[model samples]
Target chain A: MLSNLLVQLINGIALGSTYALIALGYTMVYGIILLINFAHGEIFMAGAFVGLMLVTVFKVHIIFAFLGAMLFCMIMGVIIEKIAYKPLRRSTRLAALISAIGVSIFLSNLANLVFGAKPTTFPPTEEILFKIQTYELIAGAQITNLQILTIVTSAVLMVCLQYFIKKSRIGKAMRATSQDYDTAALMGVNVNRIISYTFAIGSSLAAAGGVLVGIYFGVVKYNMGFMVGLKAFTAAVLGGIGSIPGAMFGGLLLGIGEMLAVALGLSSYRDAIAFGILILVLLIKPTGLFGTQIQKKV
Target chain B: MLVVENVDVNYGAIRALVDVSLEVHEGEIVALIGANGAGKSTTLRSISGLVKPNKGRILFEGSELQKCPPHKVVEMGISQVPEGRRVFPLMTVLENLEMGAFTRKDRANIKDDIDKVFAKFPRLEERKKQPAGTLSGGEQQMLAIGRALMSKPKIMLMDEPSMGLAPMLVQEIFNIVKEINQSGTTILLVEQNARMALAVANRGYVLETGQVVISGAAADLAKNEAVQKAYLGV
Candidate 1:
């Protein structure tokens, strides 16, 4: 029984890593502009479809396909920002938010039209990369190589992101802009370019998450982003909207919690459990577990 | 080095500045002093390109500045130490200083400028790793000024550098202002502390309701009976 639970826990972590990848995008964008890119889920879907096309049409290797998807989504994210969000930036937050939803609808429908409404099967990882291999653990528990890859890849990307934000020149500019937009501009940081970079990075990370999810689940759907995007957003808010580490922690927790519910014979209500935790966390700690209270200066 | 000519600014329906005009020449400390609603800050904001003027033009080193964006204005060799300091609260003192040189590419000079700033404000050097928010009000003000210095600006526009400080700290800030000016950067100062501003300034402009009501040498303005009664609280 303990080993069975442990296996479920490992599975939960693998799922959580993907969610965390998407959640980072949400949190970073929100931190900079305070606008929720509701269409981010659509960007994820776009990545999966792009990945599929790269593999099937171009016959690219799996690793290159994954990277190609990320690069494509980065451009897509920047284009969406320019077309939909940029003009409404000076208007009102509600206006920008409505625009985000509109873009989200437009992109998903565009994907549906291009990729069709049917669920497409991802190329088998065993055929493209290494064969599906498992390692036996204590108490006869098993861990797949794919699972290990997903977790490790997520960790490496996250660590790289953390280092970039903490140590790089542009990263310092991002932190300053997030803190105070006007002051950053006064310091000669091109606020517009920084905003564009934020969207680019966020979207690419979401794309990476999309490709990983497609590979793990072995099925890619036109509307796959909607549910996963919402869950990732929930994880972001649960971890504290603007805090980087908070989003990571929140995603892992949400993933594990959902899997545990399923393990406990509540699989049918997994979505309900995930959302219930969001509502509970909001009620108990609205600032989120790691969110700091914003102090308004006089 | 900087010129504002008959500029008018408005916020929605309200007129914030009416035909405001001011100037600061090379190697001079020019102070704009007035009451709370006298449009003092508006004049500085206009010069810094934070606000658009409906009429007239701003010339910085012989180039039009009226349409320039804030970042471009900074690139034009002007840096503003904004009112209330506006330090990035979460960033360390060193990081905040680094951000000041965002537009520059000279890495070695940037390091030298940082050292110069640290030499000027030793307290910041001591707490370089601590977040700016953790600094006391005086230290934060020093950080703000030090950060501005990192830009190696041709002219520095300081808005209310002495606001919300103890009398002793205010005096110390005024001394730093004089020291900075003597170090060859032209200064355009906006302050509510009329007496202190006039004391440090080479020339003074008294703004009332967005128009320049009085302009002359700072010593002359300090001695004017009308200026003393209204602004000096004498």
Candidate 2:
């Protein structure tokens, strides 16, 4: 029983890591522009399809496929930002949000038209990469190599992101832009370029998450991004909307909580469980777990 | 050297500045003194490219700045320490100072400039790692000035540097302003504290509503009866 629970925990963490990756994009774009890119989920879906295409059509290795998907989605994200979000920036918040939803709908429908509405099986990871390998922990709990890879990759990516934001010149400019846009421009940071870079980075991270999800679940669908994107957004809000660490923490917590609900014989209520936790967290701490209360000056 | 010639600025339907002109020559501390809502800050904003003038031109070393964006203005060597010490509240003091030099390619010299800022405001050095928002008001103001200095600008536009400070801190800030001017950067300072501003300024402009009602040498302006009656509050 203990080992079974441990296995579930490992699965939960792997799932959570992917959510965290997607959530980072949401949090970052929201942080810098104060616009919720609702179409982000579609970007994730687009990434999975791109990865599938690279693998099936291009006959590339798994690593190359993953990278190809990321690069393609990065450009796609930038294009979407420039086309859909950029022109509406000075307009009302509702206008940008509606634009995001419109793009989301448009992208999903485009993917559906291209890939068909049915779920397509991904090229099996075990066949493409290495043989299926599971390590047995104490008490016979098993952890798969894929799970390990997912968690480690997520950690590394997040760490790199943190380092870039804290130490690099462009990253510092991002933080400044996030804190105050006008002040950043006044300091000679090109605000528009920073916004584009932000969208590119966020979208690429979401794409990476998409590719990983395809490998883990062994399938891809046109609309898979909708539910997962919402969950990841919930994770972002759960941790604190604009805080990077908060998104990571929120994603892990949501993933574990959902898995644990299933472990508790509530598998039927899995979807309900995720939203329930979001509602509860919002009710208790509206600013979120890691969100700071910003004091406005006169 | 900087020049604003016959500039007019409007906000929606409201005219903020009307036919205003001023000049700051190289190596001089020129003060623009006026009451609240007298377009002092508006003029600075116009100069910094935060707001565009409806008419006329702004020249920095014979180059037009009317349509230049804010970042390009900074790249052209004009830096403004905006009102309320608008530092990046979440960033560390060191980061805030680093942002000031954002336009420069002298990566190696940035550290030296940072050290120079530290020497100017030792309190900032002591709290270098702390967030700018966590600093006391005076320290935040000091950090604002220090951050602007990081650009190594040719002319610094300071908007209400003495605003909201205690009298002693205000005096301290004005002293630092003088020292900064002595070190070779020209200054265009806007202030409500007319006495202190006039004391430090080589020349002064008295703005009423949106127009420059009085302009002369600082000493002469300070001695003017009408200037004393209105802005100087004698």
Candidate 3:
């Protein structure tokens, strides 16, 4: 039973890596503009679809398809920011929120229109890193290379992001604009350009998450982003909006919590388990685990 | 040099400034002093492109700035340390200073300017790694001014630098303002603290209800009976 728990923990890390990737995108977008891009999930779904099309129809290599998917998603993120959010900036927050929802619905239906309502499969390839080996002491428990790759990739990406934000000029500009847009603009930082770049980076992360999940699950669908996106968003809130490392921690925690709940015979209540963690965390720390509580001036 | 010719500003139906005209020459400190809500800040905002004027032209070094954006205003050698010391709260003092040189291409000179700001405000140097938000109000004000100075702007637009500082800090800040001016950068100051403002100023303009009610040399405006009774509390 102890070995089983260890195997489950390893599996949870892989699942958590995908969640962390998606969550970073969500957190970055939310951090800078405070606008939740509802279509972000659909954008991830579109990325997978883009990758699927490249591999099947165009006979592109998996590696090239992944790059194309990221580029496509980044461009889409920029357009959404420019068209949907930028013009309505002067409007009420509610208007932007509603428009975001509109973008989500529009993208989901557009995917249905373009790709059709069917699950698309990637070309058969030996993409699995290694076979899962079960241990006797951990009876009925197993681990695989896929899991290790996911965790390692997630960790590397997160560390790279942290370094970029801390040590780079554009990254510093992003943090400043996120803190206060007006002040940043007055300081000669181009606020709009920074926001667009933020969306591009966030979307690219979501694309990476999409391609990995597609490789793991073996089947890509039009609606994959709905549940995963929701979960990733929950991760962003759990860690704290605007914190780079917080999203990774939140994602991994949420993934493990879900996996453990299922492993312990509560499989039916997995959604409840995920939400329960969110509510409990909010109760303990209203601002989130890593979020700094801002004192609003009257 | 800066010139504002018959500028007008409005928010919805409320007129914030009416035919406001002002000028600041090279190597001079011009003070725009008034009570609360006199639109002194608005005038500065207009000149800095933070707020657009409804009528009239703003010319900076012979270029019209009707459609210029805020950062472009800074690139034109005009930097405004806005009211309330809007420092990047989460950023370190050094990072905030670096933001001041965002538009510049001289990476080496930018580093030197940062050192210059630290040299000017040694308190900031001690707290260089600390977040700007954690600093005292006076320190944050000094950081704000220092950040503006990082841009190497020819004309500095400052609004209410002494608004919330204690009397001692206020005096110290005024002295720093005089020092900054003496070092060759022109200043366009907007302040509600009229006495200290007029004292450091080369010339003064008293704004009332968005209109320039009185304009004179600093010493002349300080002794104006109306100015003394209302602003100086004489």
Candidate 4:
């Protein structure tokens, strides 16, 4: 029983890492602009497809493919922000939010036209990323190389992001922008550039999460980002929509809770469980766990 | 050196400033004194590139400023200590100071400049690691001024620095304003408290309901019977 619990915890962590990566995108964008950025999941889906193309059509190294996907999503995120969100910045919040929803539908449909609606499989984990090896923990519990890779990569990326925000000049400017937009510009920050950088960084992180999901599941679909995006968004909301560490913690907790449901033979209700928890959290705490003093949309 | 010629600003349907014009030459403290709705802030906002004027132009050191964004305005050696001391509340005091120097490229001199700011307001250094939001109102005001100074601005635009301060703190801010002006940075001040403003300013512009109703040397404006009756509470 103890071993079973250990296995579930490890599996939960690996799954949670991907959710955390995507949640970071949602949280960061919301932090700065107070936009939900619904199209973010489509960016994740696009990242998966880009990774698939880089690895298979171009026959590149998995590492290069991963990096390429992230870069592509970064550019795409910035372009989407420019074309969709920027013009509506002066409009009411509802207008921008509707735009975000519109962008999400447009991107997902475009992906559907290009990549087909059916799910496509990755070539093979062994042929690309690494040899899949399972290590026995104690008894009846196991850990896999893929799990380790997912958790470690996400951890590293998050740490680098934290360090950059804490240390770099642009990062400080980003924080200032998040706190007060007009004031930041008054302080000589090119706010538009900061907004672009924000979209780029958030989208890149979501892209990385998408690639990891593709590798772990060995499948990618045009609409895969739809459900996963909602789940990651739920994680963001659960952790306080605009807080960084809150997203991480919320994702892990959700993943663990889902795995716990599966362990208890309630696998079919996994999605429902995630939403139920969200409802419960919100009922108790209107602001997610790490909601700042007050982040009212201006 | 700056000049504004026949500028008009409107917010949607309501006009904020109409045919407003003013000027500030090198090495002088200029004050704009007005009542609550007299468009004092709109004038400063126009100069800082926060609002666009419908008619006329603003020139800073011979260059047009109407089309420049706020950041570009800062780059042009003009920084504003905005009303209410809108410091980045969540950021540490040191970070707020660093952000003030965001447009500067001389990374090496930033530290020395920060130390200079500390010399002027030593309390900030002791609380450098603490967030600006945690500071008292007066400390936050000092941080805002220090942060603006970090840009090495040739002209500092201050709006109502004494709006919500105690009597003693208000005097202290005014004295600091004089000291900053004496140290060679030109100033364009907006104040509802006309008494203190005229006392501190070299030249003054009296804005009444969005137009320059009176303009002259500070001493002359202070001595005007109408000015004393309306603004100075004589």
- Model 2: residues >4 Å from true position, as ranges? none
Better of 2 and 3 by DockQ: 2
Q: After superposition, how far is residue A52 of candidate 4 from its true place, in Å?
A: 0.7
lDDT tens digits, residue span A1-298, model 3: 6665666676677888888888998889888888887888988888888887887888788878988998999999999999999998888888998999999888888888887788877655464234543333355556665666667777877888889888899999999888877778888888889999999988888887888788778788878888999999999999987777889999999999888887787889988999899999999998789999643211
For every model in order, the fraction of real contacts preserved is 0.74, 0.75, 0.66, 0.79
**Model 4 segments more than 4 A misplaced:** A138-140, A295-298
RMSD of 4: 1.5
Q: Is candidate 1 or candidate 2 better by lDDT?
A: 2
Clashing pairs in 1: none
Clashes by residue pair, model 2: none
In order of DockQ, best first, we have: 1, 2, 3, 4
Q: Give the fraction of true interface contacts kept by model 1.
A: 0.74
Worst 10 residues of 1 chain A by lDDT: A289-298
Error of 4 at B227 (Å): 2.0
* Candidate 1, position B96, lDDT: 94
Candidate 3 lDDT tens digits, B80-198: 88898988888999999999888888888898888888888999999999999899989999999999998888999999999889999999999999999999899999988898899
Q: Between 1 and 4, whose lDDT is larger?
A: 4
What TM-score results for chain B in every one of the models? 0.98, 0.99, 0.98, 0.99
RMSD each, Å: 1.2, 1.5, 2.0, 1.5
